[model samples]
Target: MDRVHLNPPPAADVAERADAHSVAPLLNCLLREAAAPHGGSRDADGRAPDDGRRVYRLRGSGRLLRVLGERRPAEPEMYVSDAWQRIGHAELVKLVADELRRHTGLSNHELPAEIIDSRNALAALLTARARATAPDDLYLRSEQSLLTGHPFHPAPKARGGGPVATWLPYAPEAHARFPLTLLGLREDTVVEEGDTSALDALGEAPPGYRLLPAHPWQLDLVGRELADAFADGRLVRLGTTGFDTWPTAAIRTLYAPERDLFVKFSLDVRITNDIRRLWRHDLLKLRRTDTATAAALAAIDGPAAWLGDRGYRTADFAFEELAVLVRDGLRGRVLPGATPLLAAGLVEGFEGSPLPGAQDPAAWWEAYLAQVVPPALAAFADHGVVLEAHLQNTLVAVGTDGMPVQALFRDAEGVKLLPDVSRAAGWERLVYCLVVNHLVEIAGALAAHHPTLNPWPAVRRELARHDLPEIPALLSSPTLPGKTNLLLRWTGADGADARYLPLPNPLAG
Candidate 1:
């Protein structure tokens, strides 16, 4: 057999592929959150078009735009000179920047640049992915397969505007894996909370110091700032771990197969809506949030589980900067023989997704709803825990038949307590995260695969099984809160401060 040769595609081909991957998410944000429906374009019955292709008028520019494809917009065209002109990724960025400038009465120089960087990053990922061999484990393959992440963020692939060479070696998209950098912090400077026993097993530290593992990429970014501490012997480089860890979709989090543990680090990099560093405020409240979620999951009556963020370890001198979260891995929580795959990967698609090979699409979808919906709702109603059950945070385990048997949710940092936030606010957030962000994307992907199947009725039925007072309104509400990622970045809002615009609710019918 001949060996396969991996070579970079021509620059033009890279540009075209990058545009294909990046434009859809930006257009979805623009059309859903920014554009107004063209006048008199509603169907005869006054219903918005159900077809993926639709026409809209940009609210700011007042320009007509036509796009084909939904969930992930494609074939975007702008009406110019009384004719439709296809817009490339570069032109689309300009169009979006100009529209935002007019719509908000403000200009953002950084967002547009990030948009460019996002497209460039996608191009690099595509080139690297083509040459890379996917991991044999289906779960690992799914974890690393998100080429077009978020599907609604303008800059889903941006890496803090860094060069490709600087970040690609650790990129999950590139199927890269490397050992974690380890350090020995002086014992007096070690700060920790909860059970971080997993860290103790990574490597041994000297009598005067404790072991602290760090993401090498993060160390590279902040090394200069830490020269003083190292010089003073407060921090000692202990080299790297003996075993390698795979970076999950959330780039900062790595999965150590040997230990069956997840280590989340604080990296000063802007991924989608925020610089994804583990903030000091979040770290301070970590134990309380994780405890609430763990108890809620314990009360849940089924296999649906919560991967507890057991605890964290960091140096007191650089607490948030060097903090690392220790999370329970899949070995114990997941059912035996059932493989867990990232829910986002199921939507974005990968080499061996159960969605395409699903024998009974309707039954498969129902089984999925059964596994995913109840736990999230129960956590809210019975317990005050509001889970951020969006795609990336959720994992579905399927048995031999490829039918979903369990749902596991992670990320305590994103959870919200009921009494801390008003009931109404918590309900709205739960709805947005579980319904708009999670179920909608999965439903769309299922519908796309089996066009004849209608996914919302099953979802409505699954949600109706719950006794929450909000269910009736959720099913009948005319609109859902669609996150305004484009405007959020353009207006320089806090990433955690989510804003929304009304999007037509398919479940309303």
Candidate 2:
């Protein structure tokens, strides 16, 4: 697999802190500076500079933080900070409390303070939408995922407000202000990248301060109005949507900050177009699109309506950015008896290798194929939606006994349905994304999980057992499976070899 280099956070050195409380003064000073104008300036290279040297880069998030004073500024990169070395937990809490007070005028007790301290603090706070009452608006709901390991999800609000716009994290530098959303407060003030509505709301700066909001794209998702009514707080504000490129432009929350959910919203119009595209494939397209890859989820979502009724929770549909917000799953608090199958470590590993275990390769392989794959198929079958059951997209949580129990699928963009009931009708993209890109991951995982479960034979058997069309003939046919063999190159086997087999394309029927 190719390695993708992630841009690191701004540098902070551990040596500079007396305790976590030290971060408070730095945050206060930075927020104060962020609120002022001209207190900071762009360097010769158009970067924000401090004391004749570039202290930070102007990010899409609008606000700036100090890069390590030790590194040369011209490099234009994010590195670790020196202050973190000396900072203690007590001071960090104090700093966060002070900053929250400055922004929302509320204390730690009134808000989700513990969340504000987590790596995904900004995302969790923002994706939390105020609930709405109107039936039409109820289709939308705020979604959240973890940014890092921690317990935090914004407290559900009691009153109604507008839909949630976006939530993310924020930090500021001396004389420059950044939005609380950057720090992870739910914000609707800024509508686009580099927009500074949070600063505008703060009004005029005092003395040498300049205020800035986090970058617009940093936000997770725009909450449906229904969510606002349920969560009330002064910090949550509304912003204008000016983007005209697409009908109902929405923010899609992708994985970030080591933890976080990812979500994608489709415009009402776009959903219509997509549904049409999907229906063109086959009359059974819709049914195939909604079913789960693992038989386990199918059982739970199907005959197991009891699970959701009993305590196992499920949401109807997830918005893209909201997924990015709460992808961490209530700040890493997995409910009792429920396991998070798609954990950070598992996900990162699954991306490169399909197999689940580093040790006892043979046993791990059998366990993955037998235990993991069926639930996915079940989930999709029960839902009547062909889910993208691929490894990167699905999270199959197992119980203490190592048996699969729960299935969590992320990335709404990959979910598809038939026109009969889908908001997104005719959308082949969902089918391609979920069934093709996603389920392929499952196949890879099976291959990686065990050598005995050959990709070709396993795919064929699984497809046949699920009652999907075609098996032996497609493998012998010269065109389709042959193409896949060439494209995927199953473990270096020749496309024409007996080793290469085919699975029924539910869409083909």
Candidate 3:
């Protein structure tokens, strides 16, 4: 393991935090997807008794498990031999694997390793962070603030089990900023669409080649596969970019602050639910989906903005492997005098976070709902465009007072158009992404900080203002569709083909 340590924090401190980080999401998965609360029906509101430890029953094994904390479970203990035994990170992994094997009647050799890798990644990040200088920019700081990565992912920080040194230098959590490896693709073999004019400014290309900026990590992963292209002069290395680009929360997407542009590249590494690659199939239809989302958002009232996937650049032979997608930067997208922060980052707080110090949590919650809810609802109701407005996909810009003033949505590849999928199916996906994944997590974070604030009514009020037909049932429904990442991975389900189970709808008061 490669670690940077100057005035290093105690090794025990790093290990402890890593253990807690690893356990929380895994426990979240077990609680949501594979287990039932001890005694009667699973608690919808997650109300535990005075000690702050909650008991659960692993349905497959009938094992009684208890853990401390609600949002991020820690100090896990399991009932054994008529006694409770505390389990460490290693034991917890083994326990989870055994339970999943029994529960799904399936063995997953890969996910366990990925989960371990995620922990290892965290340890490395913690070590680097102690010595690394955090960025001064509030927005960039927020983007890189997700040290724990996806709150619900079993192995959110797994970097394809690659060498830690190889990926750590590019990790957002480490405040990494590096120059891109510039490649010049032969003009005749260059494949692209939409406005990629921003790419040319990154670096210069020779007479017959187009400027193609490749993520160095991606190149390292696939260089052997493209030996023919390089040897035959179809792809030429033209050195590196003169300036540095910071890796955002999405490790594959690098934001060049100097250019005020975002360039997403194909890293053959899995980040979160999918391999962080700009797939050709998605790229082929990028314009159509992005155009629809852009048009729908523009037509909606208020300050919602869509950061369209302007275009992609790739080689015909190594299209998917060498691809890069360009997206709109914050220059003109956000409202004037506002700082756009990653909405997901709000849940996973940083030093300058407004949520913790908010003077009026109720007012803040109302403003948050106002910025985030309308666009997704309007897009679905008016234009039949379902925006994947999950926490990671959305950006909330806050005014100087730290009140949210605007919402910006991105990732056209995740967008689904109407009639392409039935209205019912589209609505379910919208509800799951926008309400379940996005709002529920943020609300929990907000309420955790401000115990007196009940964030749901404001959410309900904001949502009810929308005229979507599904709003009535959605408000009254007892459960919302929650994507089962844990079971899906265990059962070898396709990543894109989501399978969901019922989660208590916080909106249904």
The best candidate in terms of lDDT? 1
Residue 215, model 2: Cα distance from true site in angstroms: 7.6
Give me the displacement of residue 403 in model 1, in angstroms. 0.2
Would you estimate the TM-scores of all the predictions? 0.97, 0.33, 0.97
* Candidate 1 C-alpha error for residue 494, in Å: 0.5
Per-residue C-alpha lDDT of model 2 across residues 268-329, encoded as one tens digit per residue: 21110121111112212222322222233434522111111000011112221211111222
Q: Residue 203, candidate 1: how far off, in angstroms?
A: 1.1
- lDDT of predicted model 3: 0.89
Please give, for residues 317-340, the per-residue lDDT of candidate 3 as tens digits. Answer: 988998999999898889999999
lDDT of 1 at 207: 86
Query: What is candidate 2's CA lDDT for residue 341?
Result: 46
Candidate 2: which stretches are off by over 4 Å?
1-338, 343-384, 399-405, 411-413, 420-436, 439-456, 470-509
Whole-model Cα lDDT of every candidate shown, in order: 0.90, 0.30, 0.89
Name the candidate, 1 or 2, with the larger TM-score value. Answer: 1
Write down the RMSD of all candidates, one decimal each: 2.6, 21.9, 2.8
